[model samples]
Target: MRRSIPCLCLAAALLAPAAVQARVAQARIARMHTPVATLEQVQVRLDWAEHADSGQLRIRAGRVDAPALGYHFRDLTWTCPLRRTPEDGWQCEGALRGQGVAQRALALRGQGAAPLRLGIHFDVDALTATLAQGQARLALERRTATPDLTTLILTRVPLVWAQALLAQAWEGASFGKGTLDGRLAIVAPAAAPLRVSGPLRLHAAALQNADSSIVGEGLGGDFQLAYVGSAAARVTVAGVLHGGEFLVGSTYVALPPAPVGLHIEADSAGAEGWRLPRIEWRDGDVLAGSGRARLAPDGNVRELELQAHSGDLGPLAPRYLSGWLGVLGLSGVELRGGVDMTTRIEDGALVEVTAVVRDAGLHDPAGRFGFDGLRGDLRYSAEAPVDSQLQWTAGELYGLEFGAAAIPLRSGDGTLRSRAPWRVPMQGGSLTLSDVAIRPAREDAGADIRFGMALEGIDFGRVSKALGLPAFTGVLGGEIPSAHYANDRIDFDGGLTLHLFDGTVRFSELALERPFGTAPSLTADIALKGLDLARLTEVLGFGTITGRLDGSIEGLRLVDWTPVAFDARFASYPAPGVKQRISQRAVQDIGSVGDSSFMASLQGQLIGLFSDFGYRRLGIGCRLENQICTMSGLSGSAGAQDENAFTIVEGSGVPRLDVIGFNRAVDWTTLVQRLLAAGKGEVAPVIE
Candidate 1:
């Protein structure tokens, strides 16, 4: 309606000269062209009574098209009463109707086939017009004294009414819901850039791009915008936005109920895209920032420089970081901190970052890891050397608690390294770290890290208690030559050694995958030597045995810290200084655990007379896979005469007792239950 009224007013002004000469007049033009619109088959008729001050006027056009403004109309007709004012200015007011005009103009208003009321006042030097429907109105004015300038006042106008105008600056943008009330001044000259400056108040606005990657909903704001369209266009907008949610790529922001201040200035860079000279954001004390950035033609950020601070990060994750945090499976993480940071990016890559932290802390409700009392000045640079330090009062990894340590760091040439070894106290021992180097992830590669660690005199008894294992006292001390982490996995170059039960236990080929993710996995191989079987059996609550034990567990795998597969073998062997003796209760328990039968050299009744016996050798092995344990014993083969038998104990003294196993395959879960029952003395044996 607003667009068509201007052309109608022009037609009236053109007929003014002829109207003054004749009381009744008719005129026709095959075609007419004006700066605003083009008309075909135009006709005008006017009737006046002699000595009257008003006349009946009618106008018709076969077609009116304004291609530059995205408006087209057919068979347009207008009827009005034209009156001459005391100042001799011509004024006309009436309802305008057309085929394409009413539909295109009222499409956004949802008014079906309703005529638009248009009123125009024109003198030789100045003109004003108003187009209205219901509560919505648009008024336009111009003067010959300033032909290139036009002033427009809008009241309760639907934002969709300017879709065509918005497309001139931002292609593929559509306004879904909203209304605007504002005043605008447009200066467009034939030889200069088209400029529009306005103050607009937006209410419940919603907008989205073609791909919906960028979107806003329930947005309200008071904004001042200045836009210039030329070969190198520029735009500036400053506003206070309240009660909205917007998403851009992986960043989603749910604006607080309170208003947030914002300002931006940008200039078009043609094919290179756009350059933003300044950006400012403020949301009370929760967040504040200023930045500059460049954007590619596809709307990806190419480069950025930012300096920002936050007084409280408690609400930061949900308000601004939820999209990314949810993607990384850390949605339940909580943070309480204060931080200030400065960062720079070049060519879509991060080049430098510096941050100061004040008593910041983070916790994961799932208990994977957490830290507290962190204070630091952390810095990273890709080109020049930089130094920094960070200290934490306490932390935890997995379920192990550790005391605080300070780390000195230096970075240059795209890599960061520790300046010296840092020691952390855990379980009455210290874990020392050295030669730590880190390379941050890039577009084409994941993060890379290498470090060396040494553990000294860690109390295994306390560790067992903490892990809910049976009591065993020893020291765990070892050095890992190097460890590397990449591609979501960590591999240790060396191994850990533990001293337990007067023996040595070594672990090698250790690797972990997805340590902080769902279903974490671990793989390792363990070898044991010279173990005191008497002590080991006592600690495990098994019947007493006095012997030296050796064992090897290879190809061990655990998922979620539960044993899934292994090849394990344990044996008791005779030694010069060691007694290879087994108690009667131990033999019974072994038979119960291994599903073996006893063969005594003496009578069964006589075997019961002995409380203990000496053993020559005792061995058992199991290869576990897919919930089944393939069992074997010393000198046993599948094709042997006693193919179903496997010895669990072999005695050599008078009235010797030989314990043999008949079952060769056992369910892993059932075997575990048997072992637990035996350890609890729940299995009762009968000698027959």
Candidate 2:
């Protein structure tokens, strides 16, 4: 075993002189201490025939400990024949056995348990030793002529054997699995810096730091490493990693099957920090980059500069960008593009960025947004003004497709501003954006953006069709005086206006949160005035009603575009120029949807005799919260005879018919189902 080699050499050196003077010689050492190791209960015996060329030698030790080297052995024994070569050099080769040798010793013992082989050759100026078990070998050589130098050769060696050596360079670093085949030269002189230089071939190697923030698995590489340990330590590594995966914080790299070249040179910044002066990575057509960075003692990046270009980004998402995409809630987003970029950071803040994009495209599989044919050069600076331009051929937002547009921008003093208004065509109309300014996020602040927008002649029919809603005819045109975005939320300063069914609809106090993330939410207040009820009902597939309509929806909130809470009220009032009439089918559908019963001044059975009815006024309202709708009708207060009864319709002609609802509170879902059934002409009237 490697642990006991030094003791064997010591025993041979002490006894070689005695062997020549006497045929049989023995020595017992209760305890012996050396600079590298300590030995206890050691015994040595040599037996030689008179005038013979060789002698029988045996050495045993109860314990050997080298705490500095992380080695401890117990019950060590070696039996070999000692010979004096023609050159007057000593040689020994024999079986070596020991407990607590290393992990490999345990593995070798489990596979048939053969004693290890140790061979030693030493002269006045040089010494060489080799320890082997099975097919694995470790050799050490030192020379008195160069007392400061030691060379080690390893063949089929388990990486665990170097755990202590690795810790000397990176404290608390541990080997998980793998093997090594390489050679190393160590220069460690008294009262001087220790230096190690080596070339190593690793197979399926794995390792992790104490906190597990840095991890590698299934790593295979051929590398050249040089490290110097001093007040300002330096390390250099150059290699080609063939296969593996590693994760450092939010950045995860899944190496390709083909080899990727890497090189880095770093100097110690502090007790636990590093300053990288140069770094290079090459991965064929998938990626290539070079960068320099400074890391703080707490492992945060303090300064960085990088220049990178990708020939193709189709494969970059799953392999290199998954971590960032997942953290931003854009997992599974697809990309096809080529990009070149340069970035710089100082004091943990981005100071400048420049990027050029070529025929790029991105699509979210969740159907939120998509963009194609993007060509641009974008430049940003925190200290100086920079001008840039960007253009996209087409895009889609919430399923509404829009045609191409270009944007000119200038950035300075940490703010980017648009130079000209942007007009995008959509659904037979245009959306114009102006007065745009943006500021990127900093360590202490979130992103801030402000913009103004105007909509002109947007066809609501096409909008409804695109959104899979009822085919309502209208024109949308509005101006948002200002809009601001910050902290993942957007707020509009003004409202949108739409002309629908010969009336005007307004949306105010509009705000949105997490618009592009999971579970987006929206809140707004809506008001409608003088809407043609006949046209509105016809588009909704409800039976005909000729009247004027007014409504308001307050405290409206939707999560994932589904109504969660609102107070909505709609009413019909007399119009001097418009006739107020309701058809029989409309009365029946309204009764069914409102869960009301029909009452006639003459008789309930005679209500079916009339094909239509005249109504002075009608109204309905509901305050929805917690999945319940508190229903109200024309009679806003409780009825004198029945507390729950409320008049839904008031008749004004002969044989007048009125609809009365007895239920005041209904499940929102049930009310929606009833409305849907009525719209489909599946509900029948109840007469009382």
TM-scores of the models, in the given order?
0.77, 0.81
Worst 10 residues of 1 by lDDT: 634-643
Could you tell me how far off, in angstroms, the CA of residue 259 lies in candidate 1 after the best superposition? 3.0
Q: Once all C-alphas are superposed, what RMSD does model 2 give against the true structure?
A: 5.4
Mind giving the per-residue lDDT tens digits that candidate 2 earns over 1-688?
2424555665665676677788778888888865455789988888877777778888888998865455677887887888876666788888877776544466444566666778888777777888877777888888879977878898977777777666655667788777888898877765666677899899888888777777889999999988777768788999999888887766777889898999999898657578999989998877899999987654567899999888898888877888767656677888898989999999888899999999999999988889999889988889899999989999998889899999999999988889999999988899999999999878798789999999999999999998999999999999999999998889998999999999999999999988877788999999999999999889877788899999999999998988889999999988888988887878888887777887777555677887778888888888999989888888553221477777888777876778787787889899999888878888787777
Poorest lDDT segment (10 consecutive residues) of candidate 2: 635-644
TM match of model 1 to true structure: 0.77
Which candidate tops lDDT? 2
Model 2: residues >4 Å from true position, as ranges? 1-181, 189-192, 202-218, 637-641
Residue 13 in model 2: lDDT:
58
